[model samples]
Target: MSLLENILYFQGGLGVLANMFLIIFYTCIILDHRYKPMDLIFCQLTFIHIMMFLTAGEIWLADIFESLNVKNDFKCKATFYIYRVMRGLSICITCLLSVFQAVTISPSTALLAKYKHKLKQHIIKASLYIWSFNLSFSSNLIFYVGGFTNVSETNQMKVFKSCSLFPINYIIRGFLLTVTTSRDVFLVGVMLTTSTYMVIVLFRHQRQCKHLHSISQLRTSPEKRATQTILMLVVFFVAIYWVDFIISCMSFLLWMYNPVILTVQKFVMNIYPTITPLVQISSDNRIINVLKILWSKRHQIFKKRWFFCLL
Candidate 1:
């Protein structure tokens, strides 16, 4: 198709592949009893991202629905609803990830340290609550979103090619927007707070390390590296998320959608999910070691085949 379509396809394809790989890696680790504390959270986040890309990615869900000859209204509602749910889960899980990482790296005497022992038990329960809350929170999408038709008589704001937001009472819209904004602000606030705590913890940790060892002798712990990676993710996520949030809020409040603005927003939305796996793959020693082992085995197999051919 066009250049934009090509880029969107590439982004969606890459994100889906990377997230799938991460999920598989996590699965293997869990099966082998070598899983880390963050493994479960990472797995959940990747799964939500995969769903997000599949549902909201430019042509993915729409193409599938078109092939199945689904009704446009149903398609719009389903796609938007599912995408919103996944998006909500993404932020919630990400916030949880940051908070947990902060707790994970906190000093033993710190207030957060008290929760460390109960982290495993809390993760599942917290995830369930998050899922339930998002599922309920996004129910408004089903009522407000529907198939876009060419009829100008109907006041609908087109978002996707086939989906538009139907007008609702201003009071209802205001309430929904207020609630949604509140949720986002709360989660993002938590993410930033935890991230700041982590930075301070990391700073103190580095100072202690320098005091105890020479510069060349100082080594990063696994927990420290994981914290740093999550920190990087949080910063990146917050930056991109706010951009998307601002665009979305403007569109929602004005009840207007510009094609160019929507396109940019979609691209921005995809960036975080697309980049997260690459960051994890590069930064995680466990995944790196596994890749190394797999590569060595493959190389040995190739060498054996070449030797046999020579004979």
Candidate 2:
């Protein structure tokens, strides 16, 4: 495999592993009934990222479907469709996460405070709606994508190694593009607005803390840490997401899918998913404590084995 291909595989592997770890961690917290509201959001996001990697990570679905004797066209359609759905969910859930965190941190007298209780009660319902919307919104992809034949055709736009987008009626394409763009713009606008509100809230909270306590005496609350983490993720996601969006738009518009450009886009798309779990693992005290406990148990087991061997 080429260096680019090798790098892609490594990235996919790392992201999948990290996401799996996070899912398990959140699952444990939920089972113990010690989970915060954001834990549910984090778990859902991790699951979506895992699905995205499985569908879009080069060769993952291709190899599986090929082994199953699936038709190439069907494989292409299913793979692209699922990838798009998961991609849509990623943005939607990320936006939800930011909004939820902003609400969580809002002052008691703030307008968002009244909705905080309602948000927690309706989180599951909101997630279901997001899934339903994205699943339907991306239905157009199934009609437009097909297995790419080796023969060059002016009408086909190759998006993956095995999948190309079939030309559709210009009017239909324009309508779909408009709707997709609007949905993305609206979600991104919400994310930005929430993020800005969070910054203002954090600033005021910090000033209040300074007045109440010395710098050395102050410690970060769990809410503050979580908010800061979400803020970091939102900023990073927005940056990476736009790069992928621009590349995808240009490729679709010009019907020019350069191999290098495709590879770079894939790399950019995977960045947020890959780093997200690592950030959560480092920042969350609960996950850290769990790791420490597991490590201590393993160490004790090793010591007992070594003593038995010596005896």
For model 2, how big is the CA root-mean-square deviation? 2.8
- Against the unseen true structure, what C-alpha lDDT does each candidate score? 0.88, 0.88
RMSD of each: 3.1, 2.8
- Writing each residue's lDDT as its tens digit, candidate 2 over 131-236 gives 9999998887798788888526556877778888887677777787788889988999999999999999988988888998754432558888888999999999
lDDT of 2: 0.88
Candidate 2 runs further than 4 Å off: 58-60, 214-218, 300-311
- On a 0 to 1 TM-score scale, where does candidate 2 land against the true structure? 0.92
On the 0 to 100 scale, the lDDT of residue 6 in model 1 is 77
Residue-wise C-alpha lDDT for candidate 1, range 1-311, written one tens digit per residue? 66776787798899999999999999888789787668889989999989988887535778888899999999989989999999989899999999999989899999989999988778878888999999998897698888888637787888777888888788998899899889999999999999999999988888988888754433557777788899999999999999999999888888878777777788899999999999999999888998899887997889999999999
lDDT of 1: 0.88
